[model samples]
Target: MTREVSRTRLNMLRSYAAHDHRDNFQKAEMV
Candidate 1:
């Protein structure tokens, strides 16, 4: 159960990281 929770949290973190990276790319492109 703990492992499953950790996995879910890790996935959420990865998604946020990806979103931030994409945002950064977009800002760079805009500039």
Candidate 2:
């Protein structure tokens, strides 16, 4: 159970990072 929870959390972090990266890329393009 603990392992599953950790895996889920890792996936969430990875997705969040990807989203943040995309946002930065968009802003860079606008500039």
Candidate 3:
């Protein structure tokens, strides 16, 4: 159970990182 929770948290962090990266790319393009 703990492992599953950790896996889910890791996935969420990865998705958040990906989203931030996409936002940064958009900002760079706009500039």
Candidate 4:
């Protein structure tokens, strides 16, 4: 159970990081 929770958390973090990276790239392009 603990391992599954941690895995979900890691996936969330990875997705968040990807989203952030895309936002930064778009902002840079706009500039």
Candidate 5:
């Protein structure tokens, strides 16, 4: 059970990081 929870948390973090990267890239392009 703990392993499953950790796996999901990692996946969520990875997705969030990718999203943040894209957002920053867009802002840089606008400048």
Candidate 6:
């Protein structure tokens, strides 16, 4: 159960990172 929870958190982190990366790219492009 603990492993499952951690895995879910890892996936969430990955998605958040992806979103941050996309946002950063767009901001850089605009500048």
Instruction: Count clashes in each candidate, considering only residues at least 3 apart in sequence or on different chains.
Output: 0, 0, 0, 0, 0, 0
Residue 29 lDDT (model 5): 100
Model 2, 1-31: lDDT tens per residue?
A: 9999999999999999999999999999999
Off by over 4 Å in 4: none
Model 3, position 13, has a per-residue lDDT of 100
What C-alpha root-mean-square deviation, in Å, does candidate 6 show against the real structure? 0.3
Relative to the true structure, candidate 4 reaches a TM of: 0.95
Tell me the tens digit of each residue's lDDT in model 3 across 1-31: 9999999999999999999999999999999
Off by over 4 Å in 3: none
Per-residue lDDT tens digits for candidate 4, residues 1-31, read: 9999999999999999999999999999999
Superposed model 1: Cα runs more than 4 Å off = none
What TM-score goes with each of the models? 0.93, 0.95, 0.95, 0.95, 0.94, 0.95
**Per-residue error (Å), model 5, residue 23:** 0.0
Estimate, for each residue in 1-31, the C-alpha lDDT of model 6 and write its tens digit.
9999999999999999999999999999999
Model 2: pairs clashing at backbone N, Cα or C within 3 Å: none
- Candidate 6, superposed: residue stretches over 4 Å from native: none
- The TM-score, computed over Cα atoms with residue i paired to residue i, of candidate 2 is 0.95
Give the alpha-carbon lDDT of every model. Answer: 1.00, 1.00, 1.00, 1.00, 1.00, 1.00
